[model samples]
Target: MNNENIIDIIYGNLGSMTATDQKVAHAVLTAPKDAVNYTISELAKVAQVSEASISRFCKNLDLTGFHQLKIQLAKVADDESSYYDEINIDDVQQALTNIKNNKVAEISNTLASFTTPTLKKIMALINHARILQIAAEGNTYPVVADAIYRFNQIGILAIGAESWSTSIGQTLNLITDDVLMIISNSGESKALLKQIDVAHKQGMQVIAITNRKDSPIALKADQHLRTSVRQYVLNSDYYFSRVAAITAIETLFLLLIAENRKRLSAIQNHENIISTDKI
Candidate 1:
C-alpha cells in the first residue's frame, strides 16, 4: 500500500475502514486531486467529521497529518482533469465555442452523478416531504423559483426563499417533515452551514445541490446532489455556479415529473387556472 498511488491505497483500505474513517476516505476519494488541495478544516467539514478524526485517519494510513496526506495525493493527482495553470485567455469566437463545450460537459458530468436508484430515492423523498423549501441566493434564486414552480405544478408544496433570513426562518417555523433544499456554489465558505445546522436542529432533512461534493453545503446534506465538476486555479476569486447548478436543478425537476406522473393531473389543473388569469 505504501508503494501504491495514494488514491489506490485509500480504495484498497476502504473495506477495512471504520464507518467514521470510511466517511473521510469517501470524501477524499470523491476527487483525490481536488481533495489534495482542500485544507484540513475544509476536508473535515466536507467529511462531516472533526479535524481530529482526519488526523487519526492520516495516522491510520501511516501519515503524520493532513499535510502528509496531501503530499501523497499530489503525487497521484489526475492531470487529465487538471487545467488550473492552463488559463484560457480565449478571444471572442474561441470564448463562445469554449463556453458551449464546457457547458455541455458540465451537464453530462452533473447527470452522471445520479443513478436510476438515486433518482428514485430523491423522488420518494420529495413525495414524502410535507413542504419543499428551496433556498438559494443571488442569481441562483431563479433556479430556485424554477424548481418551486415545477414542484407546485406537480402538486408538491414548495416555496422559494431567495434570502438567507428566509432560509433560517423556515427552520425556526417549519415542521420536521419539510425538506430544505439548498442550492449554492459557495464552496469552502461557512456562510450556509448555519442554515444547514438550523435545519438539522429542527429535524428537517436537507438536500444540497452544489458544484463541489466536498463543498460544505454538499457534505452536510441528508441528500447531497452535485453538479458539474468545476475547474479553476487555486485561490481563483471568480467562481460562478449558475449554469451547472441550473442544469442539476432542471434535471431533478424533470425526474420528479417523470417519476410522479400521477401528480401531473395537478399540472393540467394549474394550467387551466393560470390560463384563466392570463385572459
Candidate 2:
C-alpha cells in the first residue's frame, strides 16, 4: 500500500470522525513522529481515549489494528523528513535542486493518482459539453484562465469568470449541456460552493480540481480530480504552490488534444494567427 494514502484517508474522513476518533486523528496529524513511537496503550493515553477507540480509528482507516497504523505513520514521518532534508536555505544550488525534485515528485504523484476511467470521464465531459465555464479565486485564477485559453485554442467554447457576481451570473445561465470547472487548492471556497449549488440547480455538471478529495467543493462536484502534493509546512493551515494543480490541468489539456486530432490543426492555426500579429 502507498503509505501516503494514510494522510489522504485521515483528512478525507475528518468531517465524519467522532469526537474520540478526532482526538486520535489530531494526535496523529499533529505529531506523527510521536504517535509512531507510541504503543496502543500509549496512544490511547495520549489521545485521551480507550484502546478500543484507538482500534476503531485504525479500523476506520482500513488498517488491521494499532500496529499497522503505527507502521504507516512511521512511513509518513520518514517521507516528511526526507522532504525537509533535501532543501537547505543557505545554499542556492541546494535550494534549486530541492525545488526541482519537489516539483518532479508533485507532478509524478498527481499523475500516478489518476485512473484511466477517471481520465475518460473527464474527457467525455469536456468533449461533449456545449459550454465550459471555469471558476477560480485568488492564486487559482491564473490556472483557470490558462485552462480556458487551452480549451479555446482547441476550438472549445470555454470561458472563465473573474468575480463572484460574474460566476453567479454565468452559473445562472448554465444548461444541461454545460460544464462548470472550478479550480481550488483548499476546495473549501464558500463562493465556489454557492456557485456549484447554482450550477447543479441549472442541470450543469461540475468538475473540481483540488488537492483535498473530500473538501467541500470536491464533495459537491459531479467529478473531482485530486492533486497530491506535500503541504507547504508542518501546519495544515498553509497552502502550497499550484504546481500540482497546473500539472493536472496541463495533463487534461494534452488528453483533450489526443481525443480530437483536429484540435492540433486548430492550435497551429491559432499559433499562426498570433505569429503574424493577427488578433
lDDT of 2 by residue, 1-279 (tens): 354556555654554578888788877866778888998898888888999999999987778988998888777676552232245577989878777876776777678778799889988999999999999998788888888999999988998878879878988988999999999877888999999999999999999988767678988998888886544444233445678889988999999888789999999999988898754
Q: Using TM-score as the measure, which candidate wins?
A: 2
Reference-based lDDT, residue 157, model 1: 92
Clashes of each: 0, 0
Write one digit per residue (lDDT tens) for candidate 1, span 65-117. Answer: 88989988887576422222223555767756655665565566567666677
Which 10-residue window in model 2 sums to the lowest lDDT?
A: 230-239
Alpha-carbon lDDT of model 2: 0.80
As a whole number from 0 to 100, the lDDT of residue 106 in candidate 2 is: 70
Model 1 residue runs over 4 Å out of place are 1-91, 187-189, 229-237, 277-279
Candidate 2 regions with alpha-carbon error over 4 angstroms = 1-4, 7-68, 71-86, 231-237
Residue clash pairs of candidate 1: none
